[model samples]
Structure formats: C-alpha cells, structure tokens
Target: MKRFTCQSCGQLLHFEDARCDQCKAPLGYMPEHAILSALAPQGGGLWRPVRGCGNTALRTFCSNHAYDVCNWLVPPTEEHSDFCFACQFNRVIPNLNIPGNMERWRKLEIAKHRLFYTILRLKLPIKNRRQDPQEGLVFDFLDDSPDGAAPIMTGHSNGVITIATKEADDAYRERMRVEMGEYYRTLLGHFRHEIGHYYWNVLIRDGGRLEKFRAIFGDDRMDYQAALQRHYARLPQNNWREYYVSLYAMSHPWEDFAETWAHYFHIVSTLETALSYDMTIGPIVDGQATLTHKSDPYLLMPFDDIIAAWLPLTYAVNSLNRSMGLADFYPFVITDGVRTKLRFIHDTVREVQQAAS
Candidate 1:
C-alpha cells in the first residue's frame, strides 16, 4: 500500500484511522486518489474535507465507528457504497455474539483490506457476488457451530470465497502450519492466495489459456481431489524449496497458481515499498541500499530488473528480522524453475489487465 501523510499535521498515517496521532485531526479515506487522508477538524470530532473533494462532499463514514472495527466511509448519495467496499462483500459474518467470532471477523476483514489494496493497485476487475447477485464478489466468513449441523469446511468456490474464523487465530494458523509442514503462512497470505485461485478461475475458465497453463502448472483438468488426497497421505517433498513456495502450495495445479499469484503480489508490493523508502539495496552489487523506497516507479521495469532488486532486498529483510529474533518474513527461494512459473503468473496478470482494458 502507498504510504500516507496526514493532511492535517504532515505526520505519516495508516490507512485505517479515525483521528491523527500528531494533531488529533479527523481522518478519512480519500477515494478520489485512493489514499487515506486527514481532514481539517470541525467541532466535536466531527470532520469535513478541506473542500472541493468528491467523497467528503458526498458524505461517507463508517456506520460502525461508534463500535469500532471499520473506519471506512461511503457517500450518502451512493446508496451502494453506504457500506465500505470490504463490508459490502460479506455474505456471512459469524454470529458476533458467539464466543470469539467478532475478533475473528475483525482479523479477517483487516487482512481482506490489505488484500484489496493490492487488487486495486493492480487495477484488477473486482465485482462482488453480493453486489451483482450473479457475477460479483462476496465472502463467507464462518465458523461451524460447536454442534454438528453445517459443513465445517471453508474455501473459495466459484465467485464466492469462504474463510473459517479459526484461520484468523495466530495460534490456530501456526498449529496448522506445523501440522501441514508449511514453512510460511499468514492470514493475509491465505486471503491473497485464495483470491488468486478465484481470479484464475475467472481469467482462464475458458479453454484458450488452458494449454499454456498445462505446460506451467501441469493441468487444471487433473483430479484435484485425488491430488490433495495423495499430498495429505505422504510426506512433503524435501526438494520442494527449489520448486514451490510451500508444501501446501505444491498440492495441486490450482493451489500452485494461487500460491504463486500471492507471491507475485508480495514481491511487487515489497519492491515498490523498498523503492519508496529510498534506502540502499543489498550487498551483491556493492552500492545499492535495501531500505530504499524508490525503485522502478511504475513497475514498468523489465522482469530481470525487478528480480535483480528483490534478491538483495530479501536478504536484507531476512537479516533484519533475524536481528529482531523473528523468523525471516519471506522463507521461500525463487530458483530457476520457480522463476519460470512466476513469469507465467506475471504474464497472466498482465494479460488479465490488457484484456480487461
């Protein structure tokens, strides 16, 4: 996500905020430019844009600001946007009164918003299933009742995506990561990766992209049921580090696509962030700084140049994390085989944009 500065005090601000840290000014998302902006103060924590802005001029703040969780706004005139874009996608939010459901739902929504940041940045088409009722996006955030009435599983299907609330808990997520022998995992990773699966299904559901896809990820027509069954029955491949992001990602063609798609976003966004900070890159080249916030401004950089910058950036990040007593943030390697797969993903996303345009 692009870094934001408080319009009220010049201090940096996070995207989700109701007030500024420096000046205590009211904060609102400027949908006009898609960055969060601080508004000049009015009386009693009430706020208004500096003037001549569209979203403020229309009036759009979260209905739930009184209770917390959402800081998004929608104009009164935009009946559709009355709900924040993310809230509009919800088909099922776990019963808030249920033990830990509200906390779980909040975590999921936060990750979903981060995921949306990338989607919007990429300019990918985002149609919610709830909004369209036919072909738009929607989410099913659920937790099986302790009683056995509904199916307990949650996953993306067709245009709708389902995420179990358990996935939101770090302990639960870590437990699954250990059980599944995954080297890296996170709630945001799950959302981004699963959305990749949804988008891939949308982008290549027809036969045209199938043949090339086969050469890269094997084949979509392969039996996912059997493949998943086999993967669970056996040990994760030892050499997977050379070829896949994690063991779970190696489970099937679709999972592989989603995992790779998630990583593509990870790499692109991190690189852009590095460029924006203007820090020196890594050691191999001898002079470039890794803390930089300025790389290729528009990501129009050739594939090789992007990769060139990332290698050192990852190393620097890993070292910094180690210094802080945390595991490396990115725990996978992009070998030749992985690079080839990534190129396909990069090409696919570019094609997706081109076709949409």
Candidate 2:
C-alpha cells in the first residue's frame, strides 16, 4: 500500500478517506492511477481531479459512495455500472435494514478493498461474474440464519467467497480467535485466505500447474472433507510447524496452499507499506547489518530479497509490540519447508503476471 497525500493541500490521506482532513477537500481513489486525489465538483454529480492529480477527465464516485462505504471513482465510460471496480464483485451485501448490519458491511468493505489493492498491485488476473459466470471472483457478506440453525461459515466455494457478518464484531471475532487457537484472525486475513482458494482454481488447477503444486504443497487429491475431519479429531502434531505455516494448513494440501498463499500476500503487502514509509531496520548487535528496502516487492524484488527483509522487519515489529505488553505482531514462524512453499507461490505469481503481460 503506497502512502497517499491530498494533491491539493498535501494533507496526509488514508486509503479510506473520503475527504482530506486538513484542507477539507473531497478525496476519491483513482484505481487506474493508484492515487487518492482531491476532487473539484464539475456539475451534476461529477468531479474532476485537482491540478497535479493524475487523470484530468471527469469522474463520479462509485454508487456505493452514497452509503459511505466506498471511496473509489468510476469513469464515465463505465456509466452503465453502478459499482466501483472493487464493489462490483459483490454478489450479496449484508442486509442494511437489520440493526448493526450497515456497520458490519462497512468494516467488511474496508478489508475487501484492501485485499483488492494488493491483488491489483500484483497484477494478478481477476474476473467478476459478468466476465465468467462459472468461476469469476465474487463475495457474499451473509448473516447467520435467524432461526438459530447453522451459522454462516466463512469460506470459499467455486468463486464465491462468503464472509460471516458476525466476524466484523470485535468481541465475537476475538472470541473465535481464542476458541480456534489462532494467533491471528482479522477480516483482512479472511479475504486473503479465501482468495487464495479462488486463485488456486484459476492459476493452479485450470492453468495446468497442478503437478508442480502437488510437488510443493503435497497431493491435493486427498479428500478435503476427510482431511478437515481428521485434522480436528486428532491432537496437534509436534512436528507440524516444520512443514506448515499453520496447524490448520496441515489438514490438506489445498489448505496448505491457501495458508501459504495468504502469507505471501501478507508479507508482500506489509513490506510494500514499509517501503512506502522508507522504513529501515538496524540492530546494534555485533556482525549485524542495517536493512533497507529498495525494490518493489510486488514486481521487481527477488523472492530471496523479500524474505531477507521480512524476517528482520517482523523481529523489530514483534519486539516493539512486546515492549507495550502486546502479543507478537506476527505470530508464525517460517521454516525451510515453508520458505520453499512461499518461493513456489512467488514464482507462480510472477509467471502468471508475465504471461498475462
């Protein structure tokens, strides 16, 4: 995520900002230009970018802007569509008429938009239902049934990713984190993890990389439901960390791929944020050298360079958290096997990107 600033007044801006705080200039994110621009009203609900902001053409906020959920802009050419690039993928949004549902949907949108940020930055292929009805990316923000039956389980099926609205509640989410014994659980993590499954179908299964995937991730042909059942029924394996990113990843090759894939996104995206801020790490210990990020992790950086920067950055951040009596910022460890899997993911992404280009 690149740091953004108000083009008009130079006020620092966050990705979700709808208006610049210092100058009070309206802000909108231009996905094609990848900049948050200050807007000048043009007439009849249209806006133009302020001077120096990329794209001089008139634009309009996504229809979702009416709900204050999206800040992305829509070009005039896309007038036929009401949603922005990110919001267009929604197959179902939370029932806004229901109490607290709007807030939940807002939280979900923030995380989902961030997920799309990384996806677009990586130049990964994406198609909405309109493009490919069978396996195009889409989302369903659902609530558990009112009848007290089974709750809405957050997972991916085909191309549809269903997220439970309850996860947006901090209390409920934290409780589930403790109950599941997960070190990290957040709305963003859910999006990243589930999208990994969607990509596995697109890039590995349909793209003819299954053999290579099986080599690194193990045979995914093993029955998924049986693997999940056995995973929950058995005790945690002492050597699980040696081969998997998480205990749940040890359940099946498919899961291992998704977990590792999500971790890849986490690493690259966070590293990009660090780089945008020009962050560097230096320890005073003997024989230790200073670290600085110079390449774009999403495109130009070597996989080895990414890991080299990632480990030290995690160590520094984790120590900072410990100083404040907070849990480690990053709780997982990457072993040799996990590193190999991560490299495989990196290579696959670059391969797909190059082929697409």
Candidate 3:
C-alpha cells in the first residue's frame, strides 16, 4: 500500500478516499496503472485524471461507488463491464435493505479491495466468475439467517469465498478469535487466507506445481475432515510451532499452505507500508541501528530481505503496542520451517509473474 497524495492540493490521501479533504477534488483509482488520482469533470457524469498521466479517456467510478463501497475507476475502454476489475468478482453482496448490513458490507469491501491491491501488485492470475464459472474467484457476503436459524460460515470453496457479515463487527470478531485460540485475526487476514486457497487451486493444482508443493507443505490428499477433527479434538503442543505457522495450519496441508500464504501477505504488505513511510526501527541503545531499505517488497525484495526487515518492524511495533497496554500487534513467531514455507510462497508468486510475462 503506497501513500497517495491529492493532485489538486497535494494533501495526503488514502486508497479508500473518494474525495480529497483539502481541495474537495473527487478521487478515483485506476487499477491497471496502479494509481489513485484526483478527478476532473468531463461532463455527462464522467471524469478524467487531473494528474495527467497520458490517459485521456473519460471514466467513471465502479457501479459500487454509488454504494460507497468502491473507489476504483472503470475506463471507457472497458465498456463491456460496469464494475471495476475488483468488484466484478463479487457474486452476492449483503442485503442492503437490512439495517447495519450496509456498514458490514463496507468493512468487507475495504478488506477485499486491499486484498486485490496486493494480488494485482503481485501479478497473480485472477479471473471473474463469468470468465470461469467452475474456478474463477468470486465473493459472497452473507448474513445470519433472518429467522435466527443458522449462522453464515466464512470459508472458501472452489473459488468462491464466503464471509460472515458478523465478522465485520469488531466485538464479535475478537470473541471468535479468543474462542478459537487464535493469536492474531483481522479482516485483511481473512481475505488473504481465503484467497490463498483460491490461488492454491489456480497456481498449484492447475499449474502443475502440486508435486513441488507437497514436498514443502505435505500431502494434501489426506482426508481433510478427519484431520480437522483430530486438530480440534486435542491441541497439539509437541513440535507444532517447529513446523506449522499456526495450530489450525497443522490440521491439513491445504490449510498449512493458506496460513503460510496469508503470513506472506502480512509480511510483505506491512513491509511495503513501512517502507513507504521511510520507517526504521533503530533503537540507539549501545551500537546497533536499523535502516530502511529503498527496495520495493512487491517487486524488488527477495524473501530473505523481506524477513529481515519484517522481523525488526514486528518487534518494534509489538513493543509499542505493549507500551500502550495493548496486545501485541503481531503475536505469532516466524520459525525457520515457516520461513521455508513462506519462501516457497514468495517463489511461487514470482513464478506466476514470470508465467504471465
């Protein structure tokens, strides 16, 4: 997530901002060019980039913009679609007529859009449900039963990711995290983990990398239900951290991959944010200092460099949180075995980039 500035008044902007606060200039994001620009009126409810990046096409915000859930643009060139590339994958949005559903859906979109930002930055392959009904990425934001019958479960199947609307509520989410014994949990983490399952289907199972993946993560052919049963039946304390990223990750090979993949996103994306702010965690105690790297985590940094920077950043941030009487910002430890798995994810993402080229 790079820092954005308003072209109209040079005010700092965030990716989700739809209008610049300083100059009141409308803002729109162009995913193809990976830019968030201030918008200028072009008549007939269309807008053009005020920054002038050689693109003259008039555009409109995604249809979702009307709902205040999306800030991405739809250029005139993509006349076939009314939604932005990210929103096109949504199969079912929450029932807006229901009270509080709108706010929940907004939270979901924020996380989902952030997930797409990283996916696009990584150059990962993603197709809409229309393009590949059997295995393309799609999202379903569902609420609990209206009659209070059953709750919506958050998980991924094939390529459709379902997120329970209640997860958007911070209190409910924290309760679930504690009940599940999870050290860390967030909306972005959910998206990263679920999308990891989607990518595993596309890049490993369909891309002929299953054999290599198995060598690292283990055989995914084991009965998943039984493995999950065993995991919940007893919390393994013997050497679990030595291998898996989390206890749930130890349940199945597929989950191990997803947890590791999620951590990879957590590390790299957070590192990019740190680098963007020129942050360095140099505690000038005796004779040691940390330095910020100029390299971009998405394109330039290798797995080792990412880990090097991420470790210090996590340590500093965790300490800061502790100082404020809050829980650790990053609670999990990255072991050597986990590092190996994360490197595999890093390499696999680079492979996707190469394959696309």
Candidate 4:
C-alpha cells in the first residue's frame, strides 16, 4: 500500500486514519479516486473533497465509521445502502456484548481494508452477496461460542471468508504461529490467503480457466479432508521448499495455489509501498544497477520487474530487522517453482481483468 498525506496540512496519514493527526482535519478515503482526502463539510451532513478540486460529489463516511473502523467515503447515492464497499461484504461481525470484542473487530477491519486496497488497486472485479448471492464475496468475523464450543477457523468456503476474531489478538496469534511452527503469520496474511481461495473459485473455476489452473496448481480435485489429515499426521515432504511456499501449502493443491497467491499479493503490495517511498535497491559490487526505481507495480511493472524489486527489498528489510535483533521480515524464499506459480496467478488475474473489460 502507498503512504498517504493529509490534503489540509500535508501530514503523513496512515491507511486507517480517520482524521489528520497534525491538522486535526477529518479524513476519508475516496475509493472512486483511490485517494485519501481531507473532508470539508457541505451542510446537511454532506462532504466534499478538500484536495480533489473537480470532485464535487456529495459524500459521507461509511456507516462503519461510527465504530471508528472504516475510513472510506460513501457517496449520497449509496447512502441508502448504509455501508461502504468494504463493509458491505460483511456477513457477520463479532457479538459486541462481549468485552473487548469491538477492539478485536477493529483490528480485523484494519487488515481487511488493507486487503481490499490491493484488490482495488489491481482493478479486480468484485461481486457482493447482494449482486450475486450464489457466488458473491462475503466476510464473517466470528468469535468462539459462548459455551466453549469449537473455535472458529479462518478459511473460505464457496464465496464466504470467515476469520476467527481471536486471530486479531496479538498474543493469541503469535501463540498459534509458534504452535504451528510457522515462519510467519498475521491478520493480513489470513485475509490474503483466504481471499486467494475466493479468487480461485471466481477467476479460475467460474471463468473457464480450470484446466489451466489444474495444469499449474495440480489437481485440486484431490480429497481435501484426506489431504489435510495426512498433512497433519505426517511430516512435511522432504525438500518441501523446492516445490512449495510453506508447509501448509503442501496439504493440497488448492492450498498451494492460495499460498502462492498470497505471496503474489505480498510481493506486489510491498513493492508498491517501496515505490511510494521512492525506494531503489542497489548498485552491485560490480557497479551494475539492480532493481532501479520504477512505476506502479499494479499497472506498470511487469512480472519480472516485480520480482526484481521484491527480492532486493526483502533482503534489505531482512537485514534491517536483524540490525534491530528482530526476526526476518520475510523468511521464505521464492524458488523457481514458486515463481512459476506466482506468474500463473498474475497472468490469471490480468486475464480476468481483460475478460471483464
């Protein structure tokens, strides 16, 4: 994601900032324009962008803004809907009666919004449940049962993405990561990985690209439960890194696709963040340039360019983290096989966009 600034005072603003810290100005994200803007009231509860001179469309903050969860704008035309593009997809939210549920929900929304930022940046198509109930995208932020019922597992089924609200708790999430022996795990990773499943259903299964998908990801028709049970019961295949991005990815072909897909988003999103900061990699010992500054990764940079920028950025970030005595920012390597899968995801996304257009 790119860094944003307050239009009123030019204060650097975070993606989730609802107000400018320096200028104390109200802020909202203009998804239509893909910008964060200072808001100037237009009377009668309407607002206009302070920066976009030509943008006079009357708008209001998303209803979720009441809970201080969403920073997106909702035009008057969409006011009747009472939700923003992101919140409209939520099928369920945590029961607020429980203490601290709101905070957990807030954390979940932050990650979810970042996920949407990348999807929108890619100009990928999305269908809400209202638009296509059968296959439309939806989200469920659920908590464990009150009576000690089974815990909610973060996964996707059909078009619905369910996240265990506990994952928002830093301690719980870190515990899970250590328990599972994962190199990395986070709320954003969960969103990216699950959404990968959603896209597989849409762009590949429904878009007439299943055969090609199978060719690249292998047969997803393998019994999912059996594969999962086997994965947990047995040790990960030897030299798993030679073929998979993570151990969990080896559970099934579908998982392999999702893992690779998530990393594709990770690579592109971080590269965009780097571009926002005008970052460049290095001049090697031989004085040969490597990963020079470039255009937006979403629209301008090609597959090879993204990898070139991403690899160096990962190395630099890892080194920086080591300097601080922290774990590597990115622990996995993108082997030749992983790159092949990532390319497939990138091409598939572009192909879907072309078809939609």
- Among the numbered candidates, top lDDT falls to 2
Q: Candidate 3: which stretches are off by over 4 Å?
A: 52-54, 282-286
Instruction: Specify the poorest-scoring 10-residue window by lDDT in model 3.
Output: 281-290
Cα lDDT tens digits, model 4, 1-357, are 888988788899888998898989988887766788898988976788885534767798888998988999986567776788888899999899989999999999999999999999898888999889887999999989888778799999988999999999999999999999899999999999999999988788887888988887789899999999999999876788988899999999999999999998998898888888877785475776565658888876788878877888889899999999999999998889888899999888777667767
On lDDT, the stronger of 2 and 3 is 2
TM-score for each candidate, following the candidate numbering: 0.88, 0.97, 0.96, 0.96
* Steric collisions counted per model: 24, 0, 0, 0
Tens digit of per-residue lDDT, candidate 3, span 1-357: 888888788899998999999899999999888889988888877999985545757898799999999999997789657899889988889888889889999999999999999998998888888789798889998888879887799999999999988899999999999999899888999999999999999989998999999999999999999999998999589888989889889999999999999999988888888888888564345787758566989977877878878888899999999999999999888999998899999999988787778
Local distance difference test scores for all models: 0.73, 0.91, 0.89, 0.87
The lDDT-based order of candidates, best leading, equals 2, 3, 4, 1
lDDT (Cα, 0-100) at 145 in candidate 2: 88
300: Cα error in model 2, Å: 0.6
lDDT of 2 by residue, 220-272 (tens): 98888999999989999788898899988988998899999999999999999
Q: Please write out the lDDT profile of model 1 over residues 239-328, one tens digit for every residue.
A: 876877767777898988888888888888777776766544754335544343344522365666667778878887899999999999
The residue ranges of model 4 lying beyond 4 angstroms of the native Cα positions read: 282-285, 288-293
Of 1 and 3, which scores higher on lDDT? 3
